[model samples]
Target: MIFFEDTVSVVKVAVSLLLALASWLLIRFPAPFRHYLNPRPALTLWVSFIGLRVIPFIIVYLIMDFAPRSDTEFFYKKAIAAFAGKMVYRDFLSYHGPLFGYLISLPLYLWYNAKILIPFMAIVEFAIVWATWRYYQSSRPDALLMAVLYFLLPMPFVAMILSSEEDIWFWGVGLITLAYASRAQGSLWIGIIWGLSMIVIKSMIIVLLVPLFFLVDNKFKYVLGLAIVGIPSIVILYLLMGDAFLMPLQHSGYNMTPNIVSITRPFLSGVYNQISLTRLNTISLCITMALSSWAAIRYRHLGYRQIFPSLYVLTFGIFMLAQPSAPGFYLFMYMIVVLYEMVKIEDRSFNVQLILLNFLIVIEPIIWVIYVGMLNYDDWHTVFSSGVNTADYLIQVVEVGLLLALVWRTFVHLRSLDRAASQSFAASSQRTGSSPVS
Candidate 1:
C-alpha cells in the first residue's frame, strides 16, 4: 500500500510537470500555431472557448474523488456547518471573512456531495472568462487564450479550483467588478455593487476599489453605490455578530509571512529575527499604498482607455506584494490584466516575461513536494529545508524581477502615450498658428 501510494504521488508529479511544460511551450510558440488556435469565426470562437474552459474543468471534476484532500475539505465541512446554523466566528475560529464560508456553502444547497461543487466552481470559472472578455473588449482569439490560461495555468487550477480555495470566487467577482467598472458609460450601481460584493467576500479586496473608483466617470455615484451596499452590510453584520464582526479585521493584522522571506531568514540570522513581522508587513503595506496613490494621482488626467492599465498595475500589482501570504493565484487577476494590456500595446517582450513568470510559479510546487516529501509535512525545518528554501528564494527573485519589468513597461507605455498626445497638440498648434492653451 505504501509503495502504491508513493507511485501514485510520483505519477501525479510527472503529469503536473508535463502539463507545465506543455503550457510553457504553447505560450513560447504562440505565433506558429496562431492560425489554427486563434478563433477567426464566431463558431470556432465559441467552440474553442468551450473546449479550453469547460473540458479541463470537467476532467478535474471527474477526478476530484481521486485527488488528494486539501483545505477544500476543511472549508466544505465548515461551510456545511455554517449552513446548519453555526455562526462562522462564534461557532468556529475562522481567519477568513464571514461571507466566504457562506459563499462556499452555496454549492452545498444545490447538491450535498462535495464533488458536485467542482462543476459549480467551473461555472464560476466560465464567468471569469466572460468577465475578462467583456472587460478587455477581447477578440475571439483573446477570449479563447484567456480561457486557456485560466484553465490550464497550473497554479490557478491546482490552488484555486482543485484545492477549492475561496480565492477563485474572489477573483471571479473581482473581474466582474472590473468588467463593469471599466465601462466608459454605464450604470455605476452595477460596478459599485460588484465591487462591494468582492470586499464582502474578502475584505483584502478593498484595495481594488481604489482603481475602480478612478475607472468610472462618476466618482460620487461610485462612492455612493459602495456606501449603499457596504455601510448596510457592515451594520447588519455588526448587529448580528457584534464582537465577532471584528474577527476579519483582527485576522488581517496577523502576519503569516511569505515563503519567499524564508530565503533571507537563514542568511540574516539574528538580524532578521530582530525585525518584527508586524513592522515589516506594515512597512510593505505603506510602500504599496504610497506608490499606488502616487500613480493614481498622476494618471487621473488620462482617458479611461489609457488609465485602465495603470489602474491595474497600481491596484493588483501592489495588492500582490502587500498581502502577508504570497499565494500564486493572487497573480491570476493581475496576469489577465497584464495580458490584456500587453496585447493592446503589442509588447511581446513583457508578454514572454509574464508567461515565463507564470511557468516558474506553477512549477514551484514540484520543488516544494520534493523538498518537503509530501503535501502535509508539518515540521517547519522539513518544509523549509535548504533545498526548498533556496528554490523558494529563487522563485521570489524571479517574481520580483518580472514584476519590476512589468511596472517599467507600464511606465514606458504611459510615457509614450503622453509624448504622442503632446506631439499631436504641437502639430495642431503649428497648423492653426496659435495654441488653444495660450
Candidate 2:
C-alpha cells in the first residue's frame, strides 16, 4: 500500500508489487540461468554479481529519494545547547552511529545539499562483496547469492537503500565478521573492527563475534587479539563522546530480553499484558549460550575450522530467543553461512537436515510478514506506513517460531558433534586397549 503512496492509482501498486516479487523470484532461484549463475568467464560473472547488488541499490535509492523523511532523522535541527560543536549521541534517539553520522555528513558538507548515505552505502556494499569473494573461493557462487540475500533481506539494507538512512555500518561489521572468520589467522585488528562495528550496529553484528571467539585456535592469541582491537576503540569512543559513548551499549543491553510473551499473548487471546519477563528471558538466554559455549569447547579438538558453523548456530540461536523482537534480520544473515555449509555437506543422511533447513530459509520471511501484521493490529492503519509492518499477531507467531527453530537446530547440531566425539574416543580406546586419558 505504501508503495503506491506516490501514485493515487491502485493499479500502479499491483503492478509494482508483481514486478518486485517476480524480480525476487528470479533473484532467489536463478536456476534456469545456470550459465549465468554458475562459473562463467571471469569478467561476465563479476559484472553479473555487481549488477545484482548495484541495480537493486539504485532502485531503492530512487524510491527513498522520492519519499519524504520522517522527523526522526532530523530531530535536533535547531542548534543544541548540549552539543555546541559536538555530535549528539542521545540514547536510542540518534538514528546513525556517531562515526557513521559524521562520515555521512562529511561529503555533504563539502559537495552540496545532497544525502551522503546512499553512495557511501553502495561503496561499502561493493567492498563487502569483493572481500567475501576473496575469502571464500570454494563458495564464491554462494557468496554472490549471499550478496543478493544480504541486500534483499537485512533490515540494515532497507534502512540504507530504501529509506536512505545511515545503517551501512551493519554490513561493514557483517563483512568483517565473515572475512575474519574465514581467514586462517586470527587478527586483533579485525576483532576490534568487528567489536566497534557491533557497538554501532549491535543487532546486526553482535552474535557473529561468538564464532570468532570460539574459532580462533590459540586462546591467548584470540583473547589478546580481540581485546587489543576492541578495548581501544571503546576507550576512544568514550573519550570522544563521554557518557554518550555508553548510550549505544546501554540501549543494546536494554533490549537483550526476548519479548516472546508480549508479542504472542494477544495472538493466543491470553490476558498476559507484559511479554515474558526480561529477567527470565535473560537467564534462559544465558543458559542456552553457556550450553552452546560448552558444545564449542567440547568439540574444539575437531579442529577450529569446523567450529565456525557451530559458532554461528549457537550465537544466532541464543540471540533470537534472548530478545523479544523479530529475529528475522539476524537469522537471515546467519542463514547465508548455514546454507553455505549445507551445500558443502556430501552426506546423504544430512539431506533430511538440508530439507528442514531449506524449508526454514524459504518460509521465514513470509511468516515474518504475517507475524508483524498480527502484533501491530492496533496500529493497523499504519501497517506498511513508513517501514514495512505486518499484522502484529502474525509477527508474534513467526518470531516465536523462528526463535524456537534456531534453538532446536543448535541443540541438534551440538548433539551431532557430541556423538561424533564419542565415536572417535571409543575408536581410539579400542586401538590402545587402555582407558583414554582426558
Candidate 3:
C-alpha cells in the first residue's frame, strides 16, 4: 500500500518505528535496567541524554545531508526577519508571537544560521529535562527511567531530531505555570512572567493562564499582577502592530494536520476547502476554557502545590485535544510531564494504551505528512494542505480513540483522590459513633 515507490523511505520509517517499538517494550517494565541505570554517574546520564537528542539528526541530515524533513527549523526565519528590521505582520506573514520573532532569532544573530537554532533548542530541551527532574524530586522519580522513556518517546524526537519545531515553547509556559503553582509564592512575579510568556511564546499561553487563575490561591493578586504587566504590554503591542498584533494570536485558525479537525475536514468539505478560521478558533477556544475551568474547580480542594499534576495535565490535555492548531508534537510536553504518573498506574490495560499512545502520536505526524499525501513532507503548508487517504484516515481514528481513553484514565485517577478523602472521612465518623458527613 505504499503510495510512492520509495523503498529507502519505507526502510527508514520502518527501522525507526521498529526500534521505537522495541524500546517501548522495555518501558513496559524497567525493573531489569535499574541495576545498570542506578549505578551510572550523573554526568554520564546527562551526556547520554544530550547525545540522543542530537546524534541521529547529525548523522542523517547534518553529515549525509538528507533533504530537510520540513521547514520546521526555518521558524527562526521569523526571528531572522525581525532582526533585519522588518515589521512582523506587515513586512512578513508570520504566525508566531511578535516578540517570539525576536526571541528565537537572537540565536541566529550570534551565529547567523539555522544550525544555531539546533543548539539553542538543545539548551531549551536540556532545561526541560532538568526541570522535569527538579519539579518531581519529592516524588523521587526514577531518573534513569524518566530519561530513557523521554529519550525513546517519538514526540520529542519528531520535534528536536527530525525537524526543529518550536512548539516546545508550549512547555515554556507550562513549566512556568507549574513552577509558579509548586512554589505557592504569592508574588506578582508570575503575572509578569506570564505577561512576558504570552508575547515571548505563542498566545496559547492564554489557555494555560485561564485555569491557573482559579487553581492558585492568590486569585485577586494574580489578577492584579496580570493586569499590571499584561494590559499595557498588550496595548503597546497593539500600538506597534495595529490590528496586526492579532495576526499571530489568530494563527490557530489554520489547522495543523493530525489534529481533531483533520479528522473532520474531509466531511466538512473537500480537503482543500478553506473553513472559517474564526469559527473554528471560537468553538475550540470555548471548549478549551470551559473544560479547563471545570478542571480547576475539580482540583480546587487540593492546595496549589498539590494541584499541578492533574490541573496542568487536564487543562493542557483538553486544550490539545480540542484545538485544530495543535499538532501531535504538542503532546511532546504532555508525555514528559505525565509519563511518571502514567507509569505508576497499576492498570496494565491503561499502561499498554499509554505506551501505544506515545508511539502512535509520533506516527501521527508521519502518517499525515508522509503517508497521506504521497510523501509531501516538504513544507508546513504542503503538509497541512495534504488530504488523508483511507489508510491514514484509519490510523488517525485509532489515535483519537486512544487519546480519549488516556484522558479518561487520567480523570478517573484524579477522581479517586476525592473518593479516598470521602472514604477516610466516613470511616473516621463511624469510628467515633457520629453521623457520617454527607
Candidate 4:
C-alpha cells in the first residue's frame, strides 16, 4: 500500500535502522574472537588502534588531493600565514588555536613550494594513533570499541585528519601518553609531560593531571608536585608568547561574540531575528556544560585521586563547549570520554547512563541535519545557504553525545560504589547492635 515516495522513505529509514542495529550488536555482543582478530602478541591493542587511524589517512591522501570545501580556506590562509610570517585575522575564524596554524604551515614553508599539509596530516594522524593506542593498554574491550566508533561511524577519520585543529593529535595522543606516563612512571616526570601538553594546546591537555592524581595514593603531595611544575610553566608560556599567546584568546572571543551578545538581545522580537537563530547553539553549549558539571560533582565523592579521569573528561568537555568555535571540536573530546567509559564496566548503573547519553549524542545532529535537508524544516534554508552543512552537524551531535554519555556513566558507576560502601557500613552497624553512625 506504500506509494513510490513512501517506499523511498521506508528504504532510507530501513538503512538507518539497520546501521543502528549493527552498532548495537557490535557494542552488546561479546568479543569471544577478539584474541583472534587482535592476533599480534608482540604489539599491544593500542598500537593496533593507532595503526587503524594512521593507515587510512595515508591511503586516502594518495587517492584525493582535494581539500574538503569546509577546510580549504583554512588550509590556504594558515599556509599563507606561516610562510608570510604575519598574522591572519578573521573575526569568525576561531575553530583552532594559533598553534595549529603555525604547526600545519611549517612544512609547506620549508618545502618552499610543495603541499605540506598532506604529510603534516599524515604525521598528525600518526600521533593520534600512537597516543590513542597508548590510552588503551589496560583499557577494556568495550572502551576500545567506543574508540573505534569515534574513528569510523561518528566522525569520519578524514574529517579529523584534514581539519586545521592540531589539538586532535595532542588530545588523542597526549591523553593516552599522560595515562601511561603517570601510571608507569612517577609523579614529577608525569607532571612535566602534562605541562607540555598544556603548552601545546592549553585547554586540551589541562585535565591530564586529574586521572594522574587518582592513580597515586599520596593525593596532596602528587597534586602539589604537579602544580609546582605546571603552574609556573603555564605562566612562563603566557609571558613568553605574549601577543602570540593572546592571538588564540582573541580569536576565541571573536568567534563567540555573536552568541554572547545575543544573550542580551530578545529572542522573538522582529529586531532580534538574527540573535534568535544564534540562541539555538547557546542552548546546546549550556546543556553540555551543565551535564559535565553534574558529572564532576557526582564524581567528587570518589577519593580525590580517583576523581581525576572523570574530572579530566568532564573539564575538557566543558571547555570545548564554552569555547564556541564549532560543534566538531567539542565532539572530539566527547568521543574520547564516551569510549573511555563504554568499556570500563565497573558499576551497575553505567549502562543506563550510557544509553541515555548515546541517545542524546544521536539526536542533536539529526535535528540539525533534518533541519537542513528538508525545505519544510525551519532551519533548512538558513543553515545550508551558509558554508555549514547539515551532515557535519549531525556528526557532531552524535560524537558529543557519545562522549558525554561516557562521562555520565563513569560518574554514575563510581557513585554506585560509594552508595554500596555506605550501605555495607550501615548493615554492619545494624548487626553489631550499635546505632548506625551518622
On residues 1-438, what C-alpha lDDT tens digit does candidate 2 reach at each position?
A: 333333412332343344345434544465764455546434543564455445654554455454323221352231121233455465324533455444445444443333334555556655654555555656445455544433433333333433344333444455555556546554554565665665454424544555456555665666676677567766776786677655543433323112454444335423333444445445545655566567677676665445555566566666666554423444444544444443332333343333333333333343333323333332334444534454333444555565576567656766676687878898999898977665
Q: Which pairs clash (backbone N, Cα, C closer than 3 Å) in model 3?
A: none
The window of 10 residues in a row where model 3 has the poorest summed lDDT is 374-383
What TM-scores do the predictions have? 0.78, 0.63, 0.84, 0.57
What's the ranking of the predictions by lDDT, best on top?
A: 3, 1, 2, 4
The number of the candidate with the highest TM-score is 3
Top lDDT: which candidate number? 3
Tell me the lDDT of candidate 2.
0.48
**Which structure is stronger by lDDT: 2 or 4?**
2
Candidates' RMSD to native: 4.9, 7.2, 4.8, 8.2
How far off is residue 100 in model 2, in Å? 3.5
Angstrom error of the Cα, residue 23, model 1: value is 3.4
Task: Give one clash count per candidate, in the order shown.
Answer: 0, 22, 0, 8
Candidate 1 global lDDT: 0.58
The residue-by-residue lDDT of candidate 4 on 72-110, one tens digit each, is 456656666656676433322333444455556677756
Candidate 1 lDDT by residue in tens digits, 120-186: 6556665665566666544444555554554555555555555555554555565555456556544
What local lDDT does model 1 show for residue 121? 56
Q: Give the poorly placed runs of model 3, Cα more than 4 Å off.
A: 1-12, 67-71, 141-143, 182-187, 259-261, 264-275, 345-347, 374-388, 420-438
